[model samples]
Target chain A: MTYFAGIDVGSLSTEAVIIDEDATMLGYSIQETGADPVRAATEALREALSLVGVSREQLHHVVATGYGRINIPFADRKITEISCHAMGAHHLFPDTGTVIDIGGQDSKVIRINAEGRVLDFTMNDKCAAGTGRFLEVMAGTFGVPVQELGELSLKAQKEIPISSVCTVFAESEVISLIAQNRPREQIIRGLHRAVVSRVWGMAQSVGIEGAVTMSGGVAKNRGIVALFEENLGHSIHIHSEPQIIGALGAALLARGEIHQK
Target chain B: MHITRKEYLLEQKEKGRRLMGVFPALYPREILWALDIVPAEIWDPPLEIRQAGAHLQPYICSVVRLGLELILQGKCDFLDGFLFPHTCDSIQNLASVIYDFIGARKPCYFFYHPKIPHGHTARDYYLKNLKALAAELKRQFGPLKMDSLREKVDMGRRISELLGELYDLRAARRLDASNEAFYRTIRKGEYLFPDDYIAELEGFLTQTRSEESRNGATIILSGILPNPPQILTLLDDLDVQVGHDDLLNGSRRLLISNEKPGDPFEYMAECYFHMPPCPTRGSSISDRMRHLLSLINATGAKGVIFNVVKFCEPEWFDVPNLQEELKKRGVPSLVLDTELNQGLSGQMKTRLEAFIEIVRVHRESITTKH
Candidate 1:
């Protein structure tokens, strides 16, 4: 069977997805992005191929996405992460009019039209305070694995206040809290709340619409997701492994490109 | 040698130099240096606009409006070329408007340097941008030899290093230099004679003396485009020594080095990617605040003055977060709403006097406790 491959080379990770003509996922792989994104993408593609037991020669088309998309020399086409994310999120939820993606280093609130095309978007790629890196640093400060932060935050009995919108100052505030005998769970929850507030501010600035879907690595943080829901006063739908959405969209685009040819 | 704008214009006329005007940071000075052209920085025009009108919205930003006013008033008639970067949406569109409507005869180029101060992804993105910019410059200016380019890079780096040293002196409150002189030095270095701007600066530095005792409350200014004479003059008149400024015309223009050899294009890429970025250019607001605080601490600054140009969306987005962060860090900050023609000296003096009094009282109380 003919298959199309999509690769997404993000700041913190790389993802590869394979899909058939019908846009059904055949295989997928996600891995940490090392110093070199090109190598990471190649490795991710290999892993995806191994999972599906399909030879590379079987792939009829290839497309690349994410910040390093243009660096993938072998890709047949390269598309922007903004466009790819909107396409992937829309594919999963037809009514997802907005996509709020908090990645490793940037936060983007994309407003999409009914047809899944980007209408207007606001991106905060210059600050880490509203991104996953902020949570990762906070997690390290609490001496817990980054992945467990979401679960630990759910146990907080009180909402500790973190007024600093900067990641460095907020980290210091967290340390001060630790000194003040504050619980780690409460601090984590406060951290998530701070990120949610910042992201929500951006979403509000660009006019957030109904049926928003959260994508990118930060979407996996249930604590942040919950806080975002509470802050926005609306529920959010999440994809299975939202980080791969960019790659999935690219693969779908690749399939479309092949059909056009 | 110091020259007034009129004198500089006359000198350009005598020398038969094609005068060009550029905005800060992305003027492609190396190319101008090679082409033997006199590039000038458009800081602020003298004309007063009764109304910027509907074509230029109130939310369009003061810097762009000032530039637009300059073009509209025919103040920039002598300019043969104009180079502006995509620093913000207002400025980006301003460049296009000036090129198409006002300065239609002059060649205009807009450098697109996306925000890359947040993550590794951004760093790589900036690197790629540097490569693209180098290719574009080469295309426009024709083939540039490695040796000549290296020499130009070296000259640029040397000038930047001197500017950095001057800033260090200001931070120490050693130079009781007027704001006009400081702004002139930055304008001349970054826009006019970027490669050979050091001789004039060194001459100024030698003649200047440090203040015997620190006067008033020291504050660091943070923003994208600070009009040289207007902002600095206000601070100077208020006896507030601008300890350091992270503006495009200040430290941001001086942060990059050109020591790398072999491929000049590669060196250009390295320099552009590693340079301290302006807020409007996609740098993280948190990182900028942190850097400003560190500079303030080093300079013994009592507070920060965030003078954001009116209607500049990016700086507007950044200022609130920065102010909150500074306050959380125990740093007092004041936000000044700026317009191109607004005479801020009176309001600034009042604010500085009060701020200095507070700093003095706080310091005295700490001493008493000790």
Candidate 2:
């Protein structure tokens, strides 16, 4: 009963997943990456092993992904989240041909083929305009938890426009809106719209193909998906647990690598 | 292939060669060569900026700031004079600061290359500027000999032909060298005299296919000089091969011609106009797009990386449009804003890794489909 494992050490969080020979999920774990990716990656791998009631020696292969993929010294191989996300999304939705992944620090739009390989992709990584960090900054102004901004936006009515896409300028705009006694929900909605607008430009550049799927932590935010779907003029498919997609993809890829051996 | 700048200058001086500091972009080095002057091209001077900030606008590029800083610190005092070729607004400003404002101790010369595409009178206009620059050199140094200029022009043509051969080999994927070594080899043209540069290039090209071909996504790195050098080390680390380049301070500034069939002055003018479309020269966006796409097709690159220097207005002006055009053609590209002499950021590294992943996946996707 050989099992493959994957550890994804991201900027904001680290995740780990395990899959059996049949490609069935066993268990997974998620933890804050904090300031050190190496330690967080180890902890994530341990969590995955412990949750599945197995030792590190039980894993047939290990694949690492995310920003800290190279930092995981013990991993057998490292892969990029761009391919991981596409592979993960396609596994969940076989018909999915496009993936829109918005993470803590960047946004990426990937075009995937039926074989779960990446056809093309674009990213906005140089600036924090259309990233999760942008919304986190806005959430700080409203004194709301980053995890709760999605629910708050659902209650938005009389939605106001947040013009600036720059995080600094958008933060000031949010602060000024708060100062004006504007509704917090409306500001949250506007921030979501700003992010959607920025990410939409990249999505259009890649030219959407078949059914679109959304991945990454941002996909967990219903408000962002709803706004992005509206702009895309189609409903987006999201995994039941979207945040673990990259790790799941890595585990899947690890399985393939082992079989080839 | 190997000579220290100090050693090269000493060797040249022993041969009665005087040196002049030349700023970035188009300049007729042949004129200086005819006068027994070695134009030491200055693109990105890796030095701490202590005094240039007070003189330059905050929005000016680091390339300009560093070049100006080198002069302000008198680090370039060993040179006989300076030549400023109007490359961009930032360079134009730097020229004013050094030549017209700070009032350099040595003689100063300027060349205003035509910004727009060639017109009916463009050739004559370029020749006039060349003669004017020659007149200036005649005052500072000895008079330029017409016969010597013709020989220098032939020297320039040979250099261009050799560079073109190197490029064509790179495009055909026959040159077997790492991206860093290739660029470093090409950039040696900046300091080496024509005699040494041609011999060294010929030798380097002969040894290119000895190693195994790089196993990674092919990329075109377009922008300013591949400064910070760490980017190349990182490319080596990531296994990404730079198959071709549109680097303004590097291959983009190379004379892309082998034609010296007749008049030397007219041949020089033809080489200038025959240059591959560049953003700084105010060439049409579509023209640059066509050139880049052809390079991609020629080199089989999976993606294009625009390594734009921050505050480089000429590049920034043309990037978005060029990116849009490339996108329409289904070509993936990345824009990286960099500062010279600075280390690559962690975020930048992640982005680049992600991009390589994209290219790799894309290649797999295409291959799987076929």
**Candidate 1 clash pair list:** A126-B284, B174-B210
Best by TM-score: 2
**Tens digit per residue, CA lDDT, model 2, A1-261:** 999988878878899999999988899999889999999999998988998998999899999998888879888998888888888888889999999988888888888888788777778757789888887788887888888998888888757899999999999888898899998898889999989988888888778899999988889899999888887788999888888989999999999888867
Off by over 4 Å in 1: A1-261, B13-16, B50-54, B101-103, B118-143, B209-216, B225-234, B258-261, B345-349
What's the CA error at residue B168 for candidate 2, in Å? Answer: 3.4
User: Which docking class does model 1 fall in?
Assistant: incorrect
TM-score of each: 0.54, 0.89
**Chain A accuracy as TM-score for every candidate:** 0.96, 0.97
Candidate number of the best lDDT = 2
